[model samples]
Target chain A: MNDKKIKNVFIEGAISSEFIGRSIAKHQTKTSIGAHNIFLGQVRADEVDEKTIYAIEYTAYKDMANAKFHDIREATFKKFDLTCMHIYHSLGTVKVGEICLFVFVSSPRRKQVFKALEYVVEEIKAKVPVYGKEIFEDASHQWKVNS
Target chain B: MNLNIKYFGLLTEVTLCSEETVPFSKATVSELLDLLFEKHPDLKNKDFQVALNNEIVSKDTLITANELALLPPFSGG
Candidate 1:
Protein backbone atom coordinates (compact mmCIF):
# COMPACT_ATOMS: atom_id res chain seq x y z
CA MET A 1 0.00 0.00 0.00
CA ASN A 2 1.25 3.45 -0.81
CA ASP A 3 1.92 5.94 1.98
CA LYS A 4 -1.45 7.57 1.61
CA LYS A 5 -1.67 10.67 3.76
CA ILE A 6 -3.81 10.17 6.83
CA LYS A 7 -6.74 12.45 5.99
CA ASN A 8 -8.96 14.06 8.63
CA VAL A 9 -12.46 12.83 7.84
CA PHE A 10 -14.45 14.94 10.32
CA ILE A 11 -16.40 18.03 9.35
CA GLU A 12 -17.74 20.47 11.99
CA GLY A 13 -21.46 19.79 11.52
CA ALA A 14 -23.91 18.45 9.01
CA ILE A 15 -22.55 18.13 5.46
CA SER A 16 -24.32 20.35 2.98
CA SER A 17 -25.64 18.98 -0.32
CA GLU A 18 -23.84 21.79 -2.09
CA PHE A 19 -20.51 20.68 -0.68
CA ILE A 20 -21.20 17.12 -1.77
CA GLY A 21 -22.20 18.34 -5.21
CA ARG A 22 -19.04 20.39 -5.56
CA SER A 23 -16.97 17.39 -4.57
CA ILE A 24 -18.50 15.33 -7.36
CA ALA A 25 -18.16 18.16 -9.85
CA LYS A 26 -14.47 18.55 -8.99
CA HIS A 27 -13.88 14.92 -9.99
CA GLN A 28 -15.26 15.29 -13.50
CA THR A 29 -11.86 16.43 -14.77
CA LYS A 30 -10.61 12.91 -14.09
CA THR A 31 -12.32 11.32 -17.07
CA SER A 32 -10.60 8.00 -16.50
CA ILE A 33 -13.08 7.14 -13.77
CA GLY A 34 -15.88 5.33 -15.52
CA ALA A 35 -17.83 4.53 -12.36
CA HIS A 36 -18.42 6.56 -9.24
CA ASN A 37 -20.09 5.04 -6.22
CA ILE A 38 -21.35 7.28 -3.42
CA PHE A 39 -22.77 6.53 -0.01
CA LEU A 40 -24.44 9.12 2.22
CA GLY A 41 -25.44 8.33 5.81
CA GLN A 42 -28.34 10.42 6.97
CA VAL A 43 -29.43 11.08 10.52
CA ARG A 44 -32.73 9.46 11.31
CA ALA A 45 -35.41 10.66 13.72
CA ASP A 46 -35.87 7.55 15.79
CA GLU A 47 -38.23 7.22 18.70
CA VAL A 48 -37.31 5.42 21.89
CA ASP A 49 -39.37 5.42 25.04
CA GLU A 50 -41.74 7.86 23.39
CA LYS A 51 -38.95 10.33 22.89
CA THR A 52 -38.00 11.31 19.38
CA ILE A 53 -34.34 11.86 18.66
CA TYR A 54 -33.74 15.37 17.43
CA ALA A 55 -30.07 15.14 16.60
CA ILE A 56 -26.88 13.24 17.13
CA GLU A 57 -23.88 14.76 18.86
CA TYR A 58 -20.84 13.06 17.45
CA THR A 59 -17.49 12.82 19.21
CA ALA A 60 -14.33 10.83 18.71
CA TYR A 61 -10.93 9.97 20.07
CA LYS A 62 -9.41 12.10 17.36
CA ASP A 63 -5.95 10.59 17.17
CA MET A 64 -7.06 6.98 17.19
CA ALA A 65 -9.93 7.61 14.82
CA ASN A 66 -7.64 9.19 12.29
CA ALA A 67 -5.23 6.27 12.44
CA LYS A 68 -8.06 3.78 12.09
CA PHE A 69 -9.39 5.62 9.05
CA HIS A 70 -5.93 5.58 7.52
CA ASP A 71 -5.71 1.85 8.01
CA ILE A 72 -9.11 1.35 6.41
CA ARG A 73 -8.08 3.46 3.44
CA GLU A 74 -4.91 1.44 2.89
CA ALA A 75 -6.80 -1.82 3.27
CA THR A 76 -9.38 -0.70 0.73
CA PHE A 77 -6.68 0.27 -1.74
CA LYS A 78 -5.16 -3.16 -1.41
CA LYS A 79 -8.46 -4.99 -1.80
CA PHE A 80 -9.90 -3.05 -4.73
CA ASP A 81 -8.76 -1.41 -7.92
CA LEU A 82 -9.70 2.24 -7.68
CA THR A 83 -8.95 5.62 -9.16
CA CYS A 84 -9.58 7.82 -6.11
CA MET A 85 -11.73 8.02 -2.98
CA HIS A 86 -13.07 10.59 -0.54
CA ILE A 87 -14.72 10.13 2.84
CA TYR A 88 -16.27 12.78 5.09
CA HIS A 89 -18.06 12.37 8.39
CA SER A 90 -19.65 14.93 10.69
CA LEU A 91 -18.45 16.04 14.08
CA GLY A 92 -20.55 17.95 16.65
CA THR A 93 -24.32 18.03 16.10
CA VAL A 94 -26.12 16.83 13.01
CA LYS A 95 -29.89 17.17 13.12
CA VAL A 96 -32.29 14.54 11.92
CA GLY A 97 -32.63 14.45 8.12
CA GLU A 98 -29.12 15.86 7.79
CA ILE A 99 -26.12 14.20 6.21
CA CYS A 100 -23.49 12.88 8.57
CA LEU A 101 -21.34 10.63 6.45
CA PHE A 102 -20.34 10.74 2.81
CA VAL A 103 -18.14 8.20 1.08
CA PHE A 104 -17.19 8.31 -2.58
CA VAL A 105 -15.16 5.79 -4.49
CA SER A 106 -14.37 5.83 -8.19
CA SER A 107 -12.89 3.20 -10.41
CA PRO A 108 -12.68 2.32 -14.07
CA ARG A 109 -15.34 -0.32 -13.55
CA ARG A 110 -18.61 -0.26 -11.63
CA LYS A 111 -18.19 -3.58 -9.85
CA GLN A 112 -14.96 -2.58 -8.11
CA VAL A 113 -16.42 0.69 -6.84
CA PHE A 114 -19.51 -1.06 -5.51
CA LYS A 115 -17.49 -3.55 -3.51
CA ALA A 116 -14.94 -1.00 -2.36
CA LEU A 117 -17.51 1.52 -1.10
CA GLU A 118 -19.30 -0.97 1.11
CA TYR A 119 -16.03 -2.33 2.39
CA VAL A 120 -14.88 1.13 3.46
CA VAL A 121 -18.16 2.05 5.18
CA GLU A 122 -18.38 -1.22 7.09
CA GLU A 123 -14.80 -0.97 8.21
CA ILE A 124 -15.46 2.54 9.45
CA LYS A 125 -18.49 1.42 11.43
CA ALA A 126 -16.66 -1.46 13.11
CA LYS A 127 -13.27 0.04 13.78
CA VAL A 128 -13.14 3.80 14.11
CA PRO A 129 -13.31 5.30 17.64
CA VAL A 130 -16.28 7.56 16.89
CA TYR A 131 -19.26 7.95 19.17
CA GLY A 132 -22.71 9.38 18.78
CA LYS A 133 -25.04 10.59 21.49
CA GLU A 134 -28.66 10.61 20.47
CA ILE A 135 -30.27 13.81 21.71
CA PHE A 136 -33.98 13.47 22.19
CA GLU A 137 -36.67 16.06 21.63
CA ASP A 138 -36.98 16.88 25.33
CA ALA A 139 -33.21 17.24 25.65
CA SER A 140 -32.73 13.78 27.12
CA HIS A 141 -29.97 11.75 25.50
CA GLN A 142 -28.74 8.20 25.07
CA TRP A 143 -25.53 6.75 23.78
CA LYS A 144 -25.72 5.02 20.42
CA VAL A 145 -24.26 1.58 19.93
CA ASN A 146 -23.71 0.23 16.45
CA SER A 147 -25.89 -2.74 15.76
CA MET B 1 3.44 4.12 36.88
CA ASN B 2 1.53 7.28 36.19
CA LEU B 3 -1.08 6.63 33.55
CA ASN B 4 -3.30 9.12 31.79
CA ILE B 5 -6.77 7.70 31.22
CA LYS B 6 -9.32 9.14 28.80
CA TYR B 7 -13.05 8.58 28.79
CA PHE B 8 -15.30 8.91 25.76
CA GLY B 9 -19.06 9.05 25.19
CA LEU B 10 -21.03 7.26 27.88
CA LEU B 11 -17.88 6.45 29.70
CA THR B 12 -17.28 10.16 30.22
CA GLU B 13 -20.65 10.55 31.84
CA VAL B 14 -19.80 7.74 34.20
CA THR B 15 -16.34 9.02 34.99
CA LEU B 16 -17.69 12.57 35.32
CA CYS B 17 -14.57 13.79 33.57
CA SER B 18 -13.08 13.40 30.13
CA GLU B 19 -9.56 12.55 31.26
CA GLU B 20 -7.49 11.99 34.34
CA THR B 21 -4.20 10.67 35.62
CA VAL B 22 -3.95 7.90 38.11
CA PRO B 23 -0.88 6.37 39.66
CA PHE B 24 -0.84 2.64 40.14
CA SER B 25 1.37 -0.41 40.47
CA LYS B 26 -0.85 -2.64 38.34
CA ALA B 27 0.90 -4.70 35.66
CA THR B 28 -1.93 -5.24 33.19
CA VAL B 29 -4.79 -3.36 31.60
CA SER B 30 -7.39 -5.39 33.49
CA GLU B 31 -5.77 -4.59 36.80
CA LEU B 32 -5.88 -0.90 36.09
CA LEU B 33 -9.52 -1.20 35.13
CA ASP B 34 -10.25 -3.02 38.31
CA LEU B 35 -8.68 -0.13 40.18
CA LEU B 36 -10.66 2.37 38.16
CA PHE B 37 -13.86 0.44 38.67
CA GLU B 38 -13.24 0.55 42.41
CA LYS B 39 -12.66 4.27 42.30
CA HIS B 40 -15.63 5.00 40.08
CA PRO B 41 -18.26 2.43 40.86
CA ASP B 42 -20.56 3.90 38.21
CA LEU B 43 -18.06 2.89 35.58
CA LYS B 44 -18.45 -0.71 36.58
CA ASN B 45 -22.01 -0.69 35.27
CA LYS B 46 -21.16 1.01 31.97
CA ASP B 47 -20.22 -0.93 28.84
CA PHE B 48 -16.88 -0.04 27.34
CA GLN B 49 -13.59 -1.28 25.92
CA VAL B 50 -10.08 -0.28 26.88
CA ALA B 51 -7.43 1.00 24.53
CA LEU B 52 -3.78 1.38 25.41
CA ASN B 53 -1.51 3.69 23.46
CA ASN B 54 -4.21 4.19 20.83
CA GLU B 55 -4.76 0.43 20.24
CA ILE B 56 -7.52 -1.67 21.69
CA VAL B 57 -6.25 -4.40 23.97
CA SER B 58 -7.57 -7.49 25.69
CA LYS B 59 -7.94 -7.60 29.44
CA ASP B 60 -4.85 -9.72 29.79
CA THR B 61 -2.66 -7.38 27.81
CA LEU B 62 0.09 -5.96 29.97
CA ILE B 63 0.27 -2.26 30.65
CA THR B 64 3.01 -1.28 28.21
CA ALA B 65 2.17 2.39 27.98
CA ASN B 66 1.02 5.33 30.08
CA GLU B 67 -1.87 6.45 27.89
CA LEU B 68 -5.15 4.60 28.20
CA ALA B 69 -8.68 5.28 26.97
CA LEU B 70 -12.04 3.86 27.98
CA LEU B 71 -14.16 3.81 24.85
CA PRO B 72 -17.87 3.19 24.70
CA PRO B 73 -19.51 1.41 21.78
CA PHE B 74 -18.85 2.93 18.36
CA SER B 75 -21.79 4.32 16.33
CA GLY B 76 -20.10 5.99 13.40
CA GLY B 77 -21.39 5.49 9.85
Candidate 2:
Protein backbone atom coordinates (compact mmCIF):
# COMPACT_ATOMS: atom_id res chain seq x y z
CA MET A 1 0.00 0.00 0.00
CA ASN A 2 1.09 3.56 -0.64
CA ASP A 3 2.36 5.17 2.56
CA LYS A 4 0.58 8.37 1.57
CA LYS A 5 -2.73 6.65 0.93
CA ILE A 6 -4.04 7.06 4.47
CA LYS A 7 -5.15 10.29 6.13
CA ASN A 8 -4.10 10.32 9.77
CA VAL A 9 -4.03 13.84 11.10
CA PHE A 10 -7.05 16.15 11.58
CA ILE A 11 -7.53 19.11 13.90
CA GLU A 12 -10.89 20.86 14.00
CA GLY A 13 -12.97 22.97 16.33
CA ALA A 14 -15.95 20.74 15.90
CA ILE A 15 -16.20 17.44 14.05
CA SER A 16 -19.12 17.19 11.65
CA SER A 17 -21.03 14.22 10.33
CA GLU A 18 -19.99 15.21 6.83
CA PHE A 19 -16.31 14.96 7.75
CA ILE A 20 -16.78 11.44 9.08
CA GLY A 21 -18.61 10.39 5.94
CA ARG A 22 -15.92 11.84 3.73
CA SER A 23 -13.20 10.11 5.69
CA ILE A 24 -14.84 6.74 5.28
CA ALA A 25 -15.46 7.30 1.59
CA LYS A 26 -11.91 8.48 1.03
CA HIS A 27 -10.66 5.01 1.79
CA GLN A 28 -12.54 3.67 -1.33
CA THR A 29 -10.64 0.55 -0.45
CA LYS A 30 -11.64 -2.92 -1.60
CA THR A 31 -9.28 -5.60 -0.45
CA SER A 32 -11.86 -8.16 0.45
CA ILE A 33 -11.25 -7.35 4.11
CA GLY A 34 -12.75 -9.78 6.54
CA ALA A 35 -13.80 -6.95 8.91
CA HIS A 36 -13.36 -3.30 9.84
CA ASN A 37 -13.54 -1.78 13.30
CA ILE A 38 -14.23 1.81 14.29
CA PHE A 39 -14.33 3.70 17.53
CA LEU A 40 -16.10 7.02 18.00
CA GLY A 41 -15.81 8.93 21.26
CA GLN A 42 -18.74 11.15 22.15
CA VAL A 43 -18.94 13.61 25.01
CA ARG A 44 -21.51 12.80 27.60
CA ALA A 45 -23.52 15.04 29.91
CA ASP A 46 -22.86 14.06 33.47
CA GLU A 47 -23.64 15.44 36.89
CA VAL A 48 -20.68 15.88 39.16
CA ASP A 49 -22.03 16.45 42.62
CA GLU A 50 -24.10 19.65 42.29
CA LYS A 51 -22.74 20.53 38.86
CA THR A 52 -24.14 19.17 35.63
CA ILE A 53 -21.87 19.02 32.61
CA TYR A 54 -23.57 20.74 29.71
CA ALA A 55 -20.66 21.02 27.29
CA ILE A 56 -16.96 20.53 26.86
CA GLU A 57 -14.52 23.31 26.13
CA TYR A 58 -11.81 21.61 24.14
CA THR A 59 -8.37 23.16 23.87
CA ALA A 60 -4.99 22.08 22.59
CA TYR A 61 -1.48 23.33 22.20
CA LYS A 62 -1.69 23.10 18.43
CA ASP A 63 1.99 22.70 17.72
CA MET A 64 2.39 19.99 20.28
CA ALA A 65 -0.87 18.26 19.43
CA ASN A 66 -0.03 18.10 15.76
CA ALA A 67 3.43 16.75 16.45
CA LYS A 68 2.08 14.13 18.79
CA PHE A 69 -0.55 13.06 16.28
CA HIS A 70 2.05 12.68 13.60
CA ASP A 71 4.23 10.58 15.87
CA ILE A 72 1.26 8.40 16.74
CA ARG A 73 0.46 7.86 13.08
CA GLU A 74 4.01 6.76 12.41
CA ALA A 75 3.99 4.45 15.38
CA THR A 76 0.70 2.90 14.39
CA PHE A 77 2.01 2.22 10.91
CA LYS A 78 5.06 0.49 12.36
CA LYS A 79 2.99 -1.62 14.75
CA PHE A 80 0.27 -2.81 12.42
CA ASP A 81 -0.04 -4.19 8.92
CA LEU A 82 -3.31 -2.46 8.20
CA THR A 83 -5.01 -1.45 4.99
CA CYS A 84 -5.74 2.11 6.21
CA MET A 85 -6.19 4.30 9.26
CA HIS A 86 -7.93 7.60 9.98
CA ILE A 87 -7.79 9.69 13.12
CA TYR A 88 -9.79 12.87 13.78
CA HIS A 89 -9.72 14.93 16.96
CA SER A 90 -11.71 18.04 17.81
CA LEU A 91 -10.21 21.32 18.91
CA GLY A 92 -11.68 24.40 20.60
CA THR A 93 -15.11 23.80 22.17
CA VAL A 94 -17.26 20.73 21.69
CA LYS A 95 -20.73 20.48 23.11
CA VAL A 96 -22.15 17.64 25.13
CA GLY A 97 -23.00 14.38 23.38
CA GLU A 98 -20.94 15.33 20.36
CA ILE A 99 -18.20 13.40 18.65
CA CYS A 100 -14.76 14.49 19.79
CA LEU A 101 -12.60 11.79 18.21
CA PHE A 102 -13.14 9.33 15.39
CA VAL A 103 -10.64 6.50 14.77
CA PHE A 104 -11.07 3.90 12.08
CA VAL A 105 -8.65 1.08 11.27
CA SER A 106 -9.10 -1.55 8.65
CA SER A 107 -7.09 -4.67 7.81
CA PRO A 108 -7.51 -7.79 5.73
CA ARG A 109 -7.93 -9.78 8.89
CA ARG A 110 -10.31 -8.99 11.75
CA LYS A 111 -7.91 -9.83 14.56
CA GLN A 112 -5.27 -7.25 13.71
CA VAL A 113 -7.88 -4.57 13.15
CA PHE A 114 -9.41 -5.08 16.57
CA LYS A 115 -6.08 -5.02 18.38
CA ALA A 116 -4.77 -2.04 16.42
CA LEU A 117 -7.95 -0.04 16.94
CA GLU A 118 -7.83 -0.47 20.70
CA TYR A 119 -4.13 0.38 20.87
CA VAL A 120 -4.53 3.47 18.72
CA VAL A 121 -7.41 4.81 20.76
CA GLU A 122 -5.64 4.13 24.03
CA GLU A 123 -2.48 5.84 22.88
CA ILE A 124 -4.35 8.85 21.58
CA LYS A 125 -6.25 9.32 24.82
CA ALA A 126 -3.20 8.92 27.00
CA LYS A 127 -0.55 10.74 24.99
CA VAL A 128 -2.18 13.60 23.05
CA PRO A 129 -1.90 17.14 24.45
CA VAL A 130 -5.57 18.04 24.12
CA TYR A 131 -7.40 19.40 27.16
CA GLY A 132 -11.13 19.37 27.79
CA LYS A 133 -13.03 21.61 30.17
CA GLU A 134 -16.24 20.18 31.51
CA ILE A 135 -18.61 23.11 31.53
CA PHE A 136 -21.45 22.76 33.91
CA GLU A 137 -24.98 24.02 33.27
CA ASP A 138 -24.46 26.52 36.07
CA ALA A 139 -21.54 28.12 34.24
CA SER A 140 -18.93 26.45 36.42
CA HIS A 141 -16.30 24.10 35.01
CA GLN A 142 -13.44 21.72 35.61
CA TRP A 143 -10.62 20.54 33.40
CA LYS A 144 -10.66 16.94 32.30
CA VAL A 145 -7.30 15.18 32.05
CA ASN A 146 -6.36 11.58 31.60
CA SER A 147 -7.05 9.59 34.73
CA MET B 1 19.55 33.84 29.57
CA ASN B 2 15.78 33.78 29.25
CA LEU B 3 13.52 30.90 28.25
CA ASN B 4 10.07 31.32 26.76
CA ILE B 5 7.65 29.15 28.68
CA LYS B 6 4.16 28.21 27.59
CA TYR B 7 1.33 27.23 29.90
CA PHE B 8 -1.82 25.27 29.24
CA GLY B 9 -4.87 23.81 30.95
CA LEU B 10 -4.73 24.12 34.73
CA LEU B 11 -1.35 25.77 34.62
CA THR B 12 -2.78 28.53 32.44
CA GLU B 13 -5.66 28.92 34.84
CA VAL B 14 -3.29 29.31 37.76
CA THR B 15 -0.86 31.61 35.96
CA LEU B 16 -3.82 33.60 34.57
CA CYS B 17 -1.99 33.80 31.22
CA SER B 18 -0.54 31.41 28.65
CA GLU B 19 3.09 32.35 27.97
CA GLU B 20 5.97 34.14 29.60
CA THR B 21 9.75 34.39 29.52
CA VAL B 22 11.74 33.77 32.62
CA PRO B 23 15.42 34.34 33.24
CA PHE B 24 17.45 31.36 34.31
CA SER B 25 20.82 29.69 34.03
CA LYS B 26 21.16 26.45 32.13
CA ALA B 27 19.28 23.79 34.06
CA THR B 28 17.26 20.63 33.72
CA VAL B 29 13.47 20.82 33.34
CA SER B 30 13.13 19.74 36.96
CA GLU B 31 15.40 22.53 38.11
CA LEU B 32 13.35 24.97 36.07
CA LEU B 33 10.28 23.62 37.77
CA ASP B 34 11.89 24.20 41.11
CA LEU B 35 12.60 27.80 40.13
CA LEU B 36 9.09 28.20 38.83
CA PHE B 37 7.69 26.73 41.98
CA GLU B 38 9.78 29.05 44.08
CA LYS B 39 8.49 32.03 42.13
CA HIS B 40 4.92 30.83 42.04
CA PRO B 41 4.36 28.51 44.93
CA ASP B 42 0.76 28.06 43.87
CA LEU B 43 1.91 25.91 40.95
CA LYS B 44 3.32 23.24 43.22
CA ASN B 45 -0.16 22.25 44.25
CA LYS B 46 -1.49 21.75 40.73
CA ASP B 47 1.16 19.33 39.43
CA PHE B 48 2.12 19.68 35.76
CA GLN B 49 3.93 17.74 33.07
CA VAL B 50 6.71 19.52 31.23
CA ALA B 51 7.52 19.54 27.55
CA LEU B 52 10.53 20.92 25.75
CA ASN B 53 9.99 22.04 22.16
CA ASN B 54 6.73 20.04 21.96
CA GLU B 55 8.24 16.72 23.03
CA ILE B 56 7.31 15.43 26.45
CA VAL B 57 10.35 15.41 28.68
CA SER B 58 11.08 13.71 31.91
CA LYS B 59 11.89 15.84 34.92
CA ASP B 60 15.59 15.20 34.45
CA THR B 61 15.85 16.49 30.88
CA LEU B 62 18.19 19.46 30.53
CA ILE B 63 16.62 22.67 29.19
CA THR B 64 18.38 25.72 27.82
CA ALA B 65 17.20 29.29 28.00
CA ASN B 66 16.55 29.39 24.25
CA GLU B 67 14.03 26.54 24.19
CA LEU B 68 10.29 26.81 24.51
CA ALA B 69 9.15 25.08 27.67
CA LEU B 70 5.58 24.03 28.32
CA LEU B 71 3.90 22.81 31.47
CA PRO B 72 0.67 20.93 30.92
CA PRO B 73 -0.98 17.67 31.76
CA PHE B 74 -1.90 14.86 29.40
CA SER B 75 -5.30 15.94 28.07
CA GLY B 76 -5.73 14.43 24.65
CA GLY B 77 -8.63 12.51 23.16
Best by lDDT: 1
Candidate 1: stretches off by over 4 Å: A1-3
Model 1: per-residue lDDT, tens digit, B1-77?
A: 78899999988888889999999665888889889988899998878899976789999998978888998889996
Tell me how each candidate scores on DockQ against the true complex: 0.85, 0.72
Give candidate 2 regions above 4 Å deviation: A1-10, A29-34
- Scored by Cα lDDT, where does model 1 land? 0.91
Per-residue C-alpha lDDT of model 1 across residues A44-127, encoded as one tens digit per residue: 999998899999999999889988888888889889999998889999999999999999999999999999999999999999
**What does the lDDT read for residue A19 in candidate 1?**
98
RMSD of each: 1.5, 3.1
* Backbone steric clashes in candidate 2, count: 1
lDDT per model vs. reference: 0.91, 0.78
Clashing pairs in 2: A130-B75
The candidate scoring highest on DockQ is: 1
The estimated TM-scores of all candidates read 0.95, 0.88
